[model samples]
Target chain A: MFRGIVFAFLGGACITLQGVANSRISHDIGTWQAATVTQLTGFIMALMIYLFVRDGDLGGFRKVKPLYLAGGAFGSVIIFSEVTAIQTIGVTFTISALLIAQLLVTFLIDRFGWFGTTKSKMGAPQFIGLAMMIGGVLIMKL
Target chain B: MLIGLLLAAFAGMMVALQTIFNNRTDVHMGSWATTTWVLFMGFVASLACSLIFEGSRTFNLQQMQPWYWFSGLIGVGVVICLVLGIKILGPTFSVSVTLTAQLGFALLFDSLGWLGLEKVAFDWKQLAGVVVIVAGIYVFKFGGKKKSAEAVQSASAAN
Candidate 1:
């Protein structure tokens, strides 16, 4: 439990850090080029890590759905849309909308068991918790 | 403004979608291998787009600072952690926790004016926001302890 929380927390921190850094890189290179560079360096780093900590079989890729391979395609879209939104609407509104949107989509995914995920009904506490979380974000941004 | 808001939401959807896709990919391969594969594919796609869209622009790497390169490395961390996190915490819970941390750090950076951002004063509202988010998580996890574990199991199993 602790490990999961920590993992989620660290992942979140990295998201912000990477975004700020990527935007900075975009200022230096063009937006798309910055993305390419970020992905390239990230790929290199992942390749290095995979060498030492190779636990899973690479051949397993053949077992997964072909559509799953397109995850990286969405990665590019995430970068392009996020940067443009921030630039257009200002950071506060952009981030607020983003948080809400993420919560809504993720909650629906959890409820409906989308993409082969387990369907977990949002109990009263979970729903309230989500609402509070969303409220907190709105408060922070507004 | 509406378009901007829509774009932000669209980005959020892409993020959620990408995460699940990565998690699905992780089911067959090791986390690191999945990360490597995703980044490799992303690199190719983005490289192609960059060539097509940015062919005319020449980047002068001479003035580029060292820290700019670190984003990709940080991205490696993000993917690994999310892969682990989603497996354990499930999709919504994992992402909610992550989003909290993301916002918290962003708030801290904004307040401290780190990363070249203009300094903003930290006040009670920010503190309340953080506190409420923490409270929400606490409520969702421990407050409903009876259901939480089963919820987690089902989510992971289904994934």
Candidate 2:
């Protein structure tokens, strides 16, 4: 329960800034450009932090493989686009749409065991809840 | 209009992909390592696309201001927090609460005209939308039926 509270609070903070960051990226560069740059910047920062904190050597990176890297790139494009949408559709609506999109995609992925995700069974509640969430996002559109 | 809608939908799909990948990768690597790989790879991909389409001449670092980099750094913090939250709490609960909180924060930021953007006043449609979204999240959180007999029996005794 305690961990859950901390998670909720941290998640709240992260989501709070997500809109501002997205809006900034949109204005600073073209949607695609901003997304790409942010990813690079973020990646550089993360790598530097790892180097200083972790005792492991650079050899571990060689094992990362190109396929995983490509996967990351594809994911980055999606993230960048989503953030850009927040500016156009407002945060509330964007998030609602995101929830629906995520649920459906997750179902597909899990059902088919795509992208290394676990092959889990989707319960009835999960489907209904996802539908309700999507319906809510649609309502927000109005 | 339809084009824009489709693009947004596509972006939403991307976001989901990122989440799942990040979730899986985070297990093997720490958040920083995972994030670095994601961002660095993304940058390389973008650069390649731009260079191929717009040519190598498109690589102009001078065009970007310092503030642009600062904005990216801010995003780094946001990502770390978000990842931490997701790791600690399940994605469903974490995303639901965060989305609700984000709406409130984004509204406040928009109202203040901070970050040099045009100010948008609160309106009825926006207000109603936010309320409905929040309600929906709560409903989604608690709407599930009974769990498996084993889950129910264990869950009850655990508390």
Candidate 3:
């Protein structure tokens, strides 16, 4: 559990770092080009690791669903939409709305077993926990 | 405008969905391999989109600083961390923790005026918010365990 929280925190820090780095790159190249470059660099890095580790079978990808394979495509949309949404709706509004939307969808997925996730029913306390978290986010933005 | 709003909402859902997909894929492939697959697919998709929409536009890669190129390395870290983190913490908790940390770092960046970001004043409210988020995590941890255990049992039975 502690390890999980630490990983989560590290993931968040990486996000900020990546956003700052990507913005700089975008300023030089256009957004799409920057995205392309970033994706290429990431691909290379991951490829290097994969080659070194050589753990998983590349051929196994055929067994995975096409929808699962579309994560990368969704990632592109995420980048594009986040950039535009922040521009249109202001950062605070955009972040708040996005987080809320994310939480709601995650909850539904867990609760209803949608999108290949296990169904985890939420109790009142879980709902309160969620509300409190969202409230905290709103407060932080204030 | 409505379309934009819907897109924004969809975009948020996509983030969650992407995480779920990546996590599932990670279960089959190792984390590094999964990262490679995702990046490769994303690169191809974006490259195709760029070619189609933007035509052939060239940017002088030589003029850019070396540090800018490292963003993808950081991105690789984000993907790996998220895949592993979500597997352990579950999506909701993982997202909450990630957001809290992101907000904390964002506030730090704003106040310190690091990385060319404009300085923003920090007030007590922001501090309070951070505190509240921490409390919320505790609340969630305490509140959700029983339900989650039941879920696991039911899921196994269904399978």
Per-prediction fnat: 0.68, 0.38, 0.59
DockQ of each: 0.56, 0.38, 0.52
Provide the lowest-lDDT 10-residue window in model 2 chain B. Answer: B150-159
Better-scoring candidate (DockQ), 2 or 3: 3
Per-residue lDDT of model 3, residues B25-135, tens digit only: 766776677778888887777777767767777344665677767778888677667666777877667756777776567556556655654455766776676667657
Task: Summarize candidate 3's per-residue lDDT along A54-126 as a digit string, tens digits.
Answer: 8786667777887887776666666666555544543333444555566567667777887667667677876
lDDT of 1 by residue, A60-83 (tens): 999989898778677776777776
Candidate 3 colliding pairs: none
Worst 10 residues of 1 chain B by lDDT: B150-159
Q: What's the C-alpha lDDT at position B48 in model 1?
A: 79
Docking class of 1: medium
User: Judged by DockQ, which candidate is best?
Assistant: 1
Better of 1 and 2 by DockQ: 1
Q: For every model in order, what is the number of clashing pairs?
A: 0, 1, 0
Give lDDT tens digits, candidate 2, residues A10-119.
Answer: 55655556456656655655555665666666667767777877734333455554454455677445655565666665555555565566556655776666766545
Please list the C-alpha lDDT of all candidates, in the order they appear. 0.70, 0.56, 0.65
